[model samples]
Target: MSDDRRLKVLSAIVTDYVRTREPVGSRALVERYRLGVSPATIRNDMATLEDEGYIHQPHTSAGRVPTEKGYRRFVDEVARIKPLSAPERAAINALLSGAVDLEQVVARTVRALAQLTGQLAVVEYPSLRRTTLRHLELVALGPTRLLMVIITDTGRVEQRTVGLSGRGPDGLVDPAVLERLRLRLNTALVGRRAVEVVPVLAALAEQAPADERAVLAAVTDELIAALRPDAEERIVVAGTANLARSLDFTAIGTLLDAVEEQVVLLRLFTSEDAAHRDDADDTGTTVRIGSEIHEDALAEASVVSAAYGPGDAVAHLGVIGPTRMDYPATMAAVRAVARYLSRFLTGTEGSTPG
Candidate 1:
């Protein structure tokens, strides 16, 4: 058989198996795909494929199934990623437009992607280490208590209340001192990564007047603490139940264990090495099929991840499903959602979620 014919036969087998969740035979491929080849010719191609390790016979009498290698080839060469329909695009906009806060946007995005692709979706929280400060506010709540709020470019807001050790003559945090410190903080922090803003804040506090130094120190400490990396990176996951629907009991248990383990999920989402090596156009999607995934638990699954944010600063979001998933539709949904999410985060598409 010609090499092109063999590849076509392989593609047909992969598509049929994905749709029916069953092994595929040469006769079935000819019948279902109109491959214009005799059963004898197709069987020869199947034999070649099996011999090359692209497919395997699960049983002596059963038809062939695509191996991990075959699935990888199908995704990279055969699958034509379909574009989202108008209604699907509309649905995503409707579901995400209502979010008024960063948390709600994340929650909505995760749910929407899960429902769109029928797979477990994971979205990483916009990292403070990657986001620039948007604004800062300080409010006096009492004679010695002041509230400090830090806002990031991604619409994340973190607030902390600091107590002033030394108060003004009027027994309140002096308004003049507070205003000067606020201006200084903004001057040093605005448009800078939250994690990198610490040293600037420390320098500002050190230069403040003696009477105001105590309050400045307290405020600076709170700001840095708020921006410090959490003990575990935050990720929002949805559609875990979909795994039960598609995977067997044993497979489901193992997959769930991997998902619930934050470290494993984090490594899956944050592909620092892949990110550095990715020289594809900015919009290209990342696909890891079966063994391409480093985690043993995910050996039976595929990951479709994309970075979403303005310019180069981004957070990862995507779905995990069995390797037999519909690659075209899943990839399109992942890419489209990432586009919407990037727009929403950068304030180019809709209002920030409340």
Candidate 2:
């Protein structure tokens, strides 16, 4: 048979095996799919495919299943990621249309991606290092107590409280004093990165009161902790429950352990330094199957991922499912939801939070 015929036969076998979760035999392939070939001819083709190391036989009585290489070829060549159907698109829009803030959008996006794909979903929020300072708040707890709160442009909240050197009544340090302090802090740091707050702290010491000065110093320390690169803010995962029903125990155990090792997940999503790479398209999603995934735990699994952001700073969203996952449908759902999340995060396409 020609190579074209062999590939068609291979496609049929893979599609059938995926749908049924069973090994495929040439006889069954000929009987089920309209491949325009006899069972003997397909058997010969299957032999060739297996010789090429694309498919494997699990047991003496069983038929052939697609190997990791086979799944990769099918995903890259035979599979076409279908666009979201009208109803599916409408449902996603309806679910996300009422989001009140970035947090709501992130939560809804993860849940919707999970429900649509029937897989575990992972969504990474914007790294604090990538966000700009939007606003600052300071409240006096007493003559000796103060509270500092910092809000980032990407909507992350950071706060700290400090006890000052001198004692006085809390009510005496009113909103006016707080506002004055806020103005001074913002004047030096507004629209700059969260990582840049420390130097500004040193500058404020010359102008602030000894008591208020101590409070601001504490505020700077808190901001640095919040925005540090390794902060525990890389990824949020949902739909672990979905994994229970679909994946076998061995595979689930490996995947669960991998998830607990956040470093592994971070390396999977971001580059070595955990910075978003330039080559990754903000609009397009990446899909890795079987051996294409770096870790052994994911060898039998497939991952679909996308990045979102404003300029250089971005976050990642991804789905993990069995290698037999419905590729075209899952890819479409993941792509659409990732696009919606990009819009929600950057305010480029969706309504602003009320």
Candidate 3:
């Protein structure tokens, strides 16, 4: 019973300190919370908690604040993330709906998360290696020019226009020939991963008729260009102004610089915390508090992120903020955004509840 009560005391201290941004005193906790303990008992519980390294007194005769260890314990102990209300879910769905392209979806997501959570938000682009081709489209712009459209399973669409004038002396590509090549490319490449499509494309080119050779070569070159980068090579960030509103932060300069670097922020989303992906207890959210983030710039900040993508292709998105932020509420917002984003990419809207 004392253990449970002490945990309650610790939880109350964290809650109050996060709200007030000041040391939490036993008296303040007793008045603000329903811990159902006497003042002396609360004080004793606080003392024991401090001794356990879960909390600290910042100055002589000051109230207590949770240490990073304490925040970790509190986060681990949370039984339920605060759920998004119906309107919030609607808002997220509305924001993400009708995004015609992958870039639009990512842009809307960052805006939605930053607006919802009032924190810096980031969404990393899906890695090409993990994405599969859903379709290959060839549209004849002119007799000797065609627009090549590559659609990935993750809803990433890349388009490039190629000239076939060298092959078309009369500046005319036979419509029948273009259609045949499109069909052949789709048959050989669709549903295959980016890595798996190269050899198949090369094989198609090797056996191609003279007229189709230029188009196939163009296809091969463009496809390789599209998929050559690392996972999350492009990340979109929003809400730096949210960080500007914070008054107590000491590492703001380094953190802002890291945000600009973008590659450095990947540690919070993909690299260092890669193995900690949750079992999708709703949205596979991962929370990194303070030192857990492993970046000196973010040592005083926290990151709450989730793996978000369509089907087997996954990328990451999250909010970056001071450790004093609301974990449950922020987690819910991140989860909601990620879930909606995955739905948008996969085109399976109603299969999962938001």
Query: TM-scores across all candidates?
Result: 0.88, 0.83, 0.86
lDDT by candidate, in order shown: 0.81, 0.74, 0.80
Query: What RMSD value applies to candidate 2?
Result: 4.0
Model 1, 60-81: lDDT tens digits are: 9999999888887787777777
Q: Ten consecutive residues with minimal summed lDDT in candidate 1?
A: 273-282
Q: Evaluate residue 293 in candidate 3 and report its C-alpha lDDT on the 0 to 100 scale.
A: 74
Q: Comparing candidate 1 with candidate 2, which one achieves the higher lDDT? A: 1
Q: For model 2, where is the 10-residue window of minimal lDDT?
A: 272-281
Query: What is candidate 1's TM-score against the reference?
Result: 0.88
lDDT of 3 by residue, 140-251 (tens): 8886678889887887777777766444566677777789899999999888987787789888988999888877787677777777654336688999999988765797
Q: What's the lDDT for residue 270 in model 2?
A: 59
Worst 10 residues of 3 by lDDT: 272-281
Which sections of candidate 1 miss by over 4 Å? 140-146, 161-172, 228-232, 272-276, 279-282, 350-354
Q: Give model 3's clash tally.
A: 0
Q: Is candidate 2 or candidate 3 better by TM-score?
A: 3
